[model samples]
Target: MRISELKKKGLESLKGKWGKAVSLMLLLFLINVILPYIVEVIGSGGFVQWFDQEGTPLWSDIFGTVLSIVLIPLTIATTWFYLDLVRKGNPEITEVFAIYKDGKTSLKLIGGSILQAIFIFLWSLLLIIPGIIKSIAYSQLFFLLRDHPQYTILEAITESRKRMNGLKWKYFLMNLSFIGWGFLCLFTVGIGLLWLIPYIGTTLAAFYDELIVLQEDEQPIEG
Candidate 1:
């Protein structure tokens, strides 16, 4: 589907489910924002900012390294929660906490996430373009991890790279379609984010779903 169609259908699907949608965004907001705020009030700026204060070189800098470690799990949890909604058509706020309930899978996800950051960072040293390409390459890592937590870190990253083959531009355009909403969220001092977050999220989830379904249809049938 085109990016516009995905966003249109995604919001249409969200019409009556505003309650769950808001709740899901709120949960994510707390982890990414409130936790940082708490640290900022009690000490220096939180994770990302605190690292920025140091004079590390941008290329080898551990800023993204440290930041990725923090953000990746949140990313995983958010992806899994929304993918569940995508599958079940019901949004349970508790889905946000579902990641914590797992010990083994969580560890594996963290490992996979760090490797993702490392590979991207290494590629980035050669040229920023390669880094961006690698970013798109691994874009589906967490989503793949969601259904296949059994996948090892290497396997998860490998499969995400495979899943994204020939489809990066579509995903790129899909994300590009949200640029206006992103700026609007900034203008609102983030008030717009509550809606914008779920809007973009579900659309991406929809994109992933569309890809998975397309791949399934293309597979040679079993005997």
Candidate 2:
């Protein structure tokens, strides 16, 4: 699909489901605010000083590794929640987590994330620009697998590469739209961006869903 058409569909999808979208955005905000502390408390004994005196043991490293593992599923849960709001019209946060109750979907999301991270890391060795380019290139990957659960990691990565071709500028510009807000958050010590993060995330989710999820031969349904 053309960039213009994709953006139009994203806007239409947002307008058509404004209420659920708002609720989803709110739930997302709440989670983003609370989850970091929750994870820290659960993982870190609730205080930075908890680690200050420790020279760092294997157990602590193991604990941190396990925590990182746990975050993959949790992150997928949030991404799934947002995508459900966009595609299935379901606004329920609980239900989004519940979809991965079977655990398969969450695994896919985690695996995709790991692979994307690997790609980003390898690309970064060339220069920071390549890393950023790869990050944006594969940004839609989670959304793609969330919608099409059958996609393998290789398939999703290949498809992402294909969809990103010739549209790097478009994706960069779309992400650039949020740079001001992101910078504001950075300047304010990141508290300001918490709420806006989920909204912009879901909106961008809607953007990719509208623009690139469909098969190359398929046309988007009229809004």
Root-mean-square deviation of candidate 2: 5.6
Poorest lDDT segment (10 consecutive residues) of candidate 1: 214-223
Query: All candidates' TM-scores?
Result: 0.79, 0.71
Candidate that scores best on lDDT: 1
Best by TM-score: 1
Give per-residue CA lDDT, model 1, range 40-84, as digits (tens): 433544567655665544533344456556566666787666665
- Candidate 2 residue spans exceeding 4 A from truth: 1-58, 186-189, 214-223
